[model samples]
Target chain A: MGTITVEKANELFWLGRYAERVYTTLREFFIGFDRMIEAEEAYIEYCKIVDVPNVYESKREFLEKYPFDTENPDSILSNLYRAYDNALVLRDEIHTETLSYIQLSIYDMKKARVSIAPLIEMQKVIDNLLAFWGSVDDKVDEEKTRSIIKLGRRVERIDLYLRFRMSCDKLKTEKNKLEKRIVRTGLKYDESKLCELSSMIDSGEILLNQAIALIESLVEV
Target chain B: MEQLYKQSEVVNDLLARYGVKFGIYKNGNFKEQLFPFDAIPRVITKEEFNYLERGLSQRVRALNCFLKDIYAEKKIVKDGVLPEEFLYASSGYLAECESIMPPKGIYSHISGIDLVQSKDGTWYVLEDNLRVPSGASYPMIARELCRRSSPGTFMENKVCDNRNYASLLKQVMDYSNTGGINVIMTPGRYNAAYFEHSYLAEKTGSVLVCGSDLFVEGDHLYYRDYTGKKIQVGAVYRRISDEYLDPMTFKEESVIGVPNIMKVYKKGNVALINAPGNGIADDKGIYYFVPKMIQYYLGEESVLNNASTYLPFYQKDMEYVLENFDKLVIKDVAEAGGYGVVFGSSFTKEKKEDFIELLKREPRRFIAQEVIDFIDIDIMEGDQQVPRKADLRAFVLTGEDTYVWKSGLTRFSRNPDSFIVNSSQGGGFKDTWVLSQ
Candidate 1:
């Protein structure tokens, strides 16, 4: 690399974050959407949770359009496309096969409406993308580039929170010297132990049961 | 009966298998989108290819001479062929590069020369992309996959093999090396053309690096590995633009640029591909004078003819552009990638008047050219094979010798009615097949 222009650095960080966010959020949305099925005023409740306007006229509309509509321009599919585009530009920084995983995932994400099977058909894409991220982590060695990528994921996670207004549920956000920023998803944890917890969290480790217990501890507040 | 459509299915499948794509910003969000490949090969006959090779070579050499002179002696300006005001006023003109020489003293090591053929069969120069031009890998990779899809297509045709492009690029980098490893420097992943950056690096066996991987210490460029081993970079085929090449020298606040890399490049410790300050020679206004530069420098007539162009910097050309605003295309000198190109026919009468007044006020910002009704190539859309307007971007590598890649990138408009086929404009590309015969 000759020089990292400020514009490129911003793109690199976003590419990593958006790719990860798309993988994680898509997984989270599937779970969150499933839960809304039995809730009161389900569609409206979920809309408020995601913080997006309740544009859908019905539950069916939300299911079909919430994630796939290109017109929304901020849909799950759209964000994934954005992530992949950034990844495409940053291909040299990340592994080739890793990028291929993201490419296959977005390709699969676009056809979310076509499958007669279920959202389960997309599990492969999700798994492949997760593996891709892990490979990228193992392969890319430069700190400046890697830190910027991590920073990208951090920013994306923060934005995903702000966009969906998802109850500050995924990670722990704190006030930094200049602004509110993310540190991690727990209440003080070891960095070396994070890989294990992150994998668990990705596999639905921190769920409503965990949410309830954490809330039980803070009920007085 | 429908070979092009069949080719696309094959190309698309290959793209999926090997992976080739880029990013685009739509609705304020970035998206990684596959650069849809059309299977129909843009075929150029051996005679036409020879003509193009000669013209493009001449144009490149003349531009090279222009760069050498602009920085060293300003001979063309002294000869009264090119105006001094145009050089100083245009955005592509960089005075900072004056008196500074790059490795091997070749300004444009790789030139992505865009060209279009008219319905009547005349070729016109569309633009000269001398600044970190891309699309080489797009065709290079697409060809590899396309051949896998239809092996018979190659066996039956006389198409020129474009597989030597990477070797040519490698040779160019090696030829200019000051003494260390060759590195392919990409801005990072997420750049619009990041796939090409990495793919080319892999193909050429050069180490891929991001800006942060490189730093200049006391006029020596180094790529620091994660293990803290500093590898000296003798040459860098950087894919970033000149404005972002150095923060300390140009945009001090730019975080992606190295602080003192320019100092090191100037010190001659490292070779920069498509060196900075080269934009002056490729400027739209300067483009018109390339043929003249060839005649003056090499004492030979230009092998290529530029699309009939008018520089409003001259009174006569300004009058013609004003009168023919409805028939010509206006271009902003500083704008690139189809961003600044405006077609006269597409503008409303009111808009045409506004543009005329704008051109009068800032003629330096614009140049006008005759619209080349470029030829169309077939692309498969569903079951039908349709002809869409397309142009060719020929890649010429300059090292020990000037060699045009046997094949070039054939980008076509995906929009049914559009003429612009740049990746930035949502244009997908096809592979160009040049027959050896």
Candidate 2:
């Protein structure tokens, strides 16, 4: 019932972004993992797509260490922890039932090893994230806070989709949702940059490097 | 109750799902661990609870009056009921809090009075926790899950619902509130009792805030929202200790405290739950004088007895403690959460002599007590039920009137040999059920 603080808004937005990142990246990691089983260089491509430095010595090392590694700042576990850290602070805005999903995801991530069984176990992370977002929409009554978090989620999703070379149509839909949330939140952003990004997204002549730069600069808050 | 015990795993799983945990620093790293819940409820008969409620209420009232008198007239000291030297020498007595009356003349709006029952079934007050007492939410949420797990069990029993603790807390806040919204101020999520801080805020419908979320402007406390909207704060149920409450007043290096907020509290523009400087009354050394305080302030004999305690500051007690060093439990007055406690018998002869030397060197810093042979409650460990040392922390709330919550947090040591039952000491909790009958 209280207005979200600037610090809290930042946390909620990043909570959405990091949780979405973990969800999307873990799903994508499986695809890359399957390919890596066939050819080890498939991980290099995956690293390039996510823009994380290839730190592991071999594909086996990457598969074994990447998902659960706390040292790797861009690992799914790290992202999940970030999401939890952000969500923990926003317990007032987010319902306990909703926050519990994030907590469960983190707990499962800790339990998950580099074993083949965990590849299937990772689906629970995605399931929990979906449940988390659903619970947020239903349980969080504050429209602005929800919109801000959704905006963060949409932005992160669009960024990941573009980088991962997902379908253009999916990117456009997500970008459109992001645009609407950006407007709904009423937070300040570069209107011209958003329009420019929109034009580039629409023309399909969008250079990945240039588009990533524009997306990064799109929202300041 | 048997049905509930059978569903212990289910209740614990639900607790895990709800993030029911407490944070602790282990090996210099902050870790959050589940405060394990035992299925067996600590059931208190209605008659026993009635007696406890009255006694707890009276004790807390006397403590509150003592705080008021200490800050204002010092009548009890002047009347020779309590020594002035003992009052001023206490580390908990804040000079800045003198003559400052809290809203509605209430101090310690929430009091966690720890009591242990002897084998003979007579209860004795172990200690008073007037400063930032926690653990209420543990039992409160546990009861919620227990009822859900076995609805028929609850229906069959005459248990008084403990779900109203939050509402009762809210009522106290509202009663003592000068104006505006109630806020629960936590140090942060890293603090030991962070779960309780956030849970109580959600239950009471108060804004849960850290020190950074609040600021003092124009001598009134205000909470800043994400949208940069400033809302005036009426009551603050701060979970941080007094020393870290206001950096400007107590600890200047405390970054977790809001600067000038104590100014606001002093001005009566905002109400602070369990007003600042309450530690003076709850200090272990001062605990020896509580019964005297009851008689001095309330003009009535204490219904509950204190664990036979001896303050080393008194020459007679010091001599007695030195002579009986091997039989008493020596406690450092300033420490809490089961720390700074030493069983004299556990110390070697050399160590006992060293401790005796330290006690003589700083007599005021310690107190010795005849350790009560406290009663144990049954806890379901795996398939077997075992008796473990447990203690009740009965919460007493004072606002317009002093009242005790019928249900309390019953914490027990997981180790069969340990007497310490603090959550920080790797203890677990059980839901306390006060029979409505």
Winning candidate number (TM-score): 2
- Please write out the lDDT profile of model 2 over residues A1-221, one tens digit for every residue: 44667777788889989988999999898888888878968888888888889998898888888898888898899888999999987777787889999998876776677445777678887888999999999988878888888988988888888888887788788878888789888567899889888888887777887888788778777
Best of the candidates, DockQ = 2
DockQ of 2: 0.63
Per-residue alpha-carbon lDDT of candidate 1 for residues A1-221, written as tens digits (9 for 90 to 100): 42333444556666766776777677767776677667635867767765668888878778778878778865777778787777765555565666777777866776666775447756766886777768667866655665566655554554454445344345444112102112311122233333433343345444543333332232110
Stretches of candidate 1 off by over 4 Å are A1-98, A105-116, A119-221, B1-4, B16-19
Candidate 2: regions farther than 4 A off: none
User: Considering just chain B, what TM-score does every model have?
Assistant: 0.97, 0.98
| Candidate 1 lDDT by residue in tens digits, B67-100 | 8888889988888988888789877777778888
lDDT scores in order:
0.75, 0.89
Worst 10-residue stretch by lDDT in candidate 1 chain A? A174-183
* Per-residue error (Å), model 1, residue B359: 2.3
TM-score of 1: 0.74
